[model samples]
Target: MPRNDDLLDNPRSPRVRAVAKLAKRDARSETGLFLLEGPQAVSEALTYRPELVLELFATPTAIERYDTIEQLADEAGIDVEFVTEAVLSTMADTVTPQGLVAVCRQFPTSVKEIFAAADGEGPKLIAILEEVRDPGNAGTIIRAADAAGADAVIMTGRSVDLYNPKVVRATTGSLFHVPVAVGIELPAIIARCREAGVQVLAADVKGDDLLAARQGGLLDAATAWLFGNEARGLTDENLARADAAVVVPIYGHAESMNLATAASVCLYESAFAHRA
Candidate 1:
């Protein structure tokens, strides 16, 4: 059992106020920490690297539902804070709070780490998102990547903050299962992928190749796929940089698939190809 404190009960506490505001981009950037909410995400964090957790907060009721969380906290030597429902609501992004939230240190791995992990006989599969504005979409894509067993997810340009509360929730705790890198330059990332012998395939609405048809052969040759934003899709510059472009075939009258859906389709195709 860990000691529980109600220090956050003081709304005027400068430290509490500062961390609350750090949920925003500027503060996250300045401090290199992000806020995670709900028991699942916090549980994943504890599993991935307990040392990354800075603090844990829970409503009395929340601790009951997620008893394992308290055990993890005890084993990891993390401080737990008990806060009122009103205070939790203020900090929670969801309407129905799961009764827990955590402040975590950012785990920003370098490009070198990504490459070093891929050194083996088999090909490497990586997912890159360019300027993906929606945190939900980004988080879903990260979850999809994990499902497909991709190496890592790379976020470039002004994509949604990986630590965004919604994104963290959307990941359903897979955010900690996989490695994520953000704020990278697209062109530079392209060069790095090429140097590492990872073929870059960009997903586009008007792509020349159909995702289903190119399945076993196409993906077996490459190492990774690039997914773009929902609204505009991949920019011409990024598309041109890809070794090839792939599109998920749509027979229905639907205009296009959601960004996350499209990425999932592509990732599954790659996984299938590798399995074959």
Candidate 2:
């Protein structure tokens, strides 16, 4: 149980400042901590990964507003501290704090660890992003993968940091649901997927149509999908490395699909196919 004396009322408190600094990548790296804001992300963390949470801060109104979180924290025996709204604002990255915030340790997975813990016969579907710098897109892709029941998400070196504030917020708690492997090399991931008997499919314009793949039984296989940068898509070598490069057909006049949209389409198609 949390002590009443642990209330943090000073917005400028040194401890608050340190926790707020987690918004910066270097600070998160140096301190090995990150921030999860809003009720959804915070609730998911408390439910799925309570051990990773170091502390939770909320206004009195917020605690009452989200009574479930308070109950969860109490059940898990994690302390919940009262903080002034102003103090919470200083520690939060978004304009609307949702009145509840949590400081949690980052959980990163290795490619091998992902394969080891995969369900059923093996990992059936995976989403891989290379050099994807948009934190929001990265987060959305993670959400899509989680929704589609993909085994894991791998972000290559130079991709957006999973702990970025915008990324964490955009995930809407799916970040905690999905296994994310960050900062691995593209070739290494491809090799590992191959070793694990998964077919690597790079999403590209100059490849087999996604519809054709789905209809032809290609989507039913254990698949690892690679989506590249927003502007450039995947490199030629990356495409060449894949078992097959695949494309989603567009009926609309739009030039192409957005990063996250394409990812959801591809992942869900595979998921539905596997289940069928």
Candidate 3:
């Protein structure tokens, strides 16, 4: 058991108050950092092994429930602070507070860095999301991409911020496992993929190709999957740029699948083809 300090007792401390207020977009933008609340999210952050964790707060009740986390934090030399329930609730996003939260520095990544990290081999499996406005969907896609062993995740146009608390929570810590490049120009990225011999496949409801059966025959050559926004789907420009359009067959009279579900289906299909 780690000792609880005075810092935890003062919920209105300048830093603690700042973290509480900084949950807003404007404050996060100003600081280039975001707040992560809940035990699950904080546990995932530990896996990332962040170089600088500003603070760690846990309610006594939370420490009792998550003994493993407490032990891990002690081993990692992380200081644990005990806060009042009211304080914890103020910092939490949910009606029921999980009793753990942490503030961490943001690490920005770029396309050049990703290419360099790949040792010039180029990404064999990439997922490109164009203007996905929902943070939950975006985070889920990233988590799926990581699970499918994708080389990278590219966000184009005006997509949701990857570091949004909702997105971070959705990723469940897969955010650290994957390389994400945001605000990329779609057309230019497509051209770069073509130059690298990566086949660009777009996911479209009206696509002529079926995703699963095409394995080892048509889609075997594709190296990347492109997904678009939920409401409008892919734009004409994106569709025109794709080497091929792939669609998942839906039955039982559903209008369409959710964006995150559609992306997961397509990514898994590509993974299957690669294995085949």
Winner of 2 and 3 under TM-score: 2
Put down candidate 3 lDDT per residue, 1-276, tens digits, no spaces: 445554356667776788787667787778877777777777777756645466788888888998777777776788778787778877766678688888777765687765553554777788998888898999999999999988889888578887788887888778777888887899878887887788988888768656454743666664778888889988887898998888888877998789999888888877877787
Q: C-alpha displacement of 95 in model 1, angstroms?
A: 3.1
Rank by lDDT (best first): 2, 1, 3
Better of 1 and 3 by lDDT: 1
Highest TM-score against the true fold, candidate: 2
lDDT (Cα) of model 2: 0.90
TM-score winner between 1 and 3, please give it. Answer: 1
User: lDDT, candidate 2, residue 266?
Assistant: 93
TM-score of every candidate = 0.92, 0.95, 0.90
Predicted structure with the largest lDDT when compared to the true one? 2
What does the lDDT read for residue 231 in candidate 1? 89
Q: What is the lDDT of residue 134 in candidate 2?
A: 95
What's the lDDT for candidate 1? 0.82
